[model samples]
Target: MKLSFNIALRFLNSSKGQTFLIALGIAIGVSVQIFIGSLIQGLQIDLVDTTIGSQPQITITSTSDDKLIGDYESRLSDISSDYEGVKHVSPSADGPALVTSDEENYSILVRGLSFEAAEGIYKTKERLVEGSLPENKNEVLIGTTLKDESGIQIGDEVDVLTSSGENQALTVTGIFDFQVANLNSSWVLTTLETAQSMFSYDDRITGIEMQVEDVFLADTISSDIQADLPEDLLAENWKDQNASLLSGLNGQSVSSYMIQVFVMISVLLGIASVLAITVVQKSRQIGILKAMGIRDSAASLIFVFQGLMLGIAGAILGILLGLGLAYVFTRFALNPDGTPVVPLYINPGFIALSAGFAIVVSTLAALIPARKSSKLNPIEVIRNA
Candidate 1:
């Protein structure tokens, strides 16, 4: 083993330029893999954060037109204690209503929530643009777009007419912007009690909104929740509600993997071809070694050692190159306000996986050339020389 390693080192050192070029090729391939993988992962994270960061992963709601979940408090308690991965569960009641201001009248959805529980699902307190969350019954928080369209000021009282033909005067205590224009324009936030009263829910909630520790696991958890609940109650997850988004993310991941696979294949081919040519150029030296009684297995191992060295050295250089590229991207790719356009999070496991695959693939690429080295005819080579 020592003899094989020494011979491999000597060969690589002797053909310094060729070895360097082959190593450089491998390095470039690996660096690109790291960069592309990290870029896609970061983009997916950002997309998810924007779309559902403040939204619930799973929701329990009534399936019937009554729009009321019976014994919701007990159900919520059961889910909180029994389900794994369940984070925060918030009960909310909402319904369509006519919200009229002095200047305009618009149809909008009115949502009622408990302050602390609502914060868990929507981060409502953090997103408050004006005033605080609804502190008492009939005091509501309005969406910014709704406020602007209706020409309603913070202290204005709005008339809310429920579907049941009941009219109630509600105070606009605060304004919020959820970033989604549709949500901002058509949603009114109120207290759980007020919503139940407005919707005639009478001691019942329309649904339970819940966030989970792992968003991706929401679907499975939702299925489990549904099984535990009655037939009239249904559980839905964010993934179910956003199928198109999940499809796009999956497609992006597949394409990225394909690109990385092709690049790795190219790197493997380059290393294999270089090692093959090296064997041909050094046939005479190999024949001499065989004639001097160096075993075929040991001869084969020389090329294997070369592969190991190249894989290790190149992968290290590739990791460093990848890190530098990531830093450059994050530094320069910024929004108008100076925040990163796409956040870059480099996982150590991903780096390790790339390097490990490169080393294994590079070693495998040397097998054919290594076998050729082991099969050289000493006498024939000497005669040819």
Candidate 2:
């Protein structure tokens, strides 16, 4: 093994330029894999965070009438208590309402929520960008999108009129930036008492927002909730509500994997081409080594070592460059509201996987040339030379 290493090192050092080129090819492949993988993962995280932050993990509602779930809170509690993975549950009432400002009027989804019950469950209050959450029955919290569209500022009074012809004046206590493109456009939040009062529906709720301990268990828990619910009520998980987003994320992940596979194949081809050329250039030397009683296996091992070295060098460089690029992207990109667009997260598992992939490709690339070099006839080569 030591003799093989020494010979491989001698060969590599003698052809420094070629060795560097081989390493660069491997590095480019590794860089593409790392950078693209990280970017896609980052986007997935952003989508999940944005969607989940604005919507509950699971929701329980009425299949018959929107008021059924709210009116049956006690029965809902009984069913929710039977589930082990439920983190918290809060009742909500939502309906389409007209919100009018001095400058403009817009239609929005008015959601009625309990301040105390929804604090931890929905994280409704934490996203407040301006003013405070509604403290009285006549106060309201508007989404940033609504605030922008209507040009309503904090402390302004907005008239909320229900579809049932009930009208009430609400003080704009707060404006919240949920960072959801769609939700921001049409959501108006208010205290449950205020919403029920405006809609003239006492003790009624539209749905129940449920937070789960394990996000991956959402479907299971949602199924259990549905089974336990009254026939008139329905249960839906976040995955169902955001099906398109989840599907798009899954597609992106698969695409990223496919890209990495292609990149590895390209790198493998490059390494193979370089090694084949090296074999031809050193045919005389290989013949001499064989004549000196070096085993065929030993000769093959030398080329394998060279390929491995090239792959390692390239992969290391690629990882560094890819990480640097990811950092740059995360640091400078901004959303419409001038906040950071996406969060960058890199897992150790991904790094290990990428590096292992590069090494495997390098080893495979060296196989054919190494085998051919090992089979050279020493006497015939010397005579031909």
Candidate 3:
């Protein structure tokens, strides 16, 4: 084995130009796989954070009616008591409404919440970019996007009309910049009492939002709540609410894997081509080794070792390059809303998988040439040389 490895090392050192080319090919392939994988993973994390940060991890709503607001507070309270993972539950009333200022009018979603109960979950007061959260029933907080479109500022008075035909003038106590495109553009926050009064639905709520102690257990807890709740109420996890987005992100991840596989195949083909050329070029050397009583298996091992060395070298270089590229991309890339994109985490599993893939491809690439070297007849090879 030592002899085989030494011979392999000698060949590699002797043919510096060829060894470098093959290693470079493998390095490029591995780097691309790593960089793309990181990109996909990063996007998936961002999508999940954006979705879950803005909305509840689980929502309990009425399935019988399209609108969420009604006299289900008693049922909600009951479910809240029964669920084990439920950390905090806040009942919300949501409906379409119009906000009008002297200069502009915009349609918006009005959500009513119990300020104290919601603070623990949504942290509404902390997220307020300007002014304070609503202190009285008449005050409201609006998203920054809503305020900008209406040309309104903190302390400005605006007329709001609910879908049920109730209208009231509200003082904007705060402007929140969530930095999320979907949330910022359409939501208006107000106290539960104020929302009920404006919508003329006192003692009713649209839905209940639950914060779970364990996010990973959300599916199980949501299922438990659904089974215990009335048939009319539906419990949904964050993934269920944003199925399309999650599915798309998953598809992107799968696509990244496919790209890595394709890269491996391409690199293997290049290695195979290089090995085949090396065999033809070293026919005389193989003839001399055979003449010196070297077995076919030993001769085969020599080339296999060479391929393994090239693969290992290339994979190491690729990992470094790929990680650097991913770092650069994450540092510079921006979301649609112009915020710095958070980096995608590169797990150890991915690195191991990439390395294993390179080794496998390298071994496979040497097989044909190894067989050719093993089959060379000393007499014919020496005469041809």
TM-score of 2: 0.82
| lDDT for each candidate structure | 0.90, 0.81, 0.83
- Higher-lDDT candidate among 2 and 3? 3
Off by over 4 Å in 2: 70-88, 96-108, 116-123, 144-169, 179-186, 196-204, 211-221, 330-343
Clashes of 1: 0
lDDT of 3 by residue, 1-385 (tens): 8888999899999999999989989888988988887778777776676667545898887776555546666766876788787888889988798888875678888988988888767888778899998879879888888777778899888888888777889999998877775677788899998887887777788889978877657889999888877778788987666678767877897888889889899999899889988998888998999999999999999889988999999999888888988878876887787665766578778877887788778888988799989999999999988
- Maximum-TM-score candidate: 1
State how far residue 230 of model 1 sits from its true place (Å): 0.6
Model 1 per-residue lDDT at 122 = 92
Among these predicted structures, which one has the highest lDDT? 1
Q: Which prediction has more favorable TM-score, 1 or 3? A: 1
What local lDDT does model 3 show for residue 182? 60
TM-score for candidate 1: 0.96
The worst-scoring run of ten residues by lDDT in candidate 1 lies at 96-105
Q: How would you encode candidate 2's per-residue C-alpha lDDT over 1-385 as one tens digit per residue?
A: 6777788889999999888888878888888888889888888877776668545788877777444555456865775678898877788877788877774668888888886877766576688888998888788888888777778889887777789877878788988877775677788888887777777668878878878887768999999878867788788998877778878988999999999999899899888888988888888998998899999999998888888877788889888877887788877897787666767779778977898889888988988789988889999888887
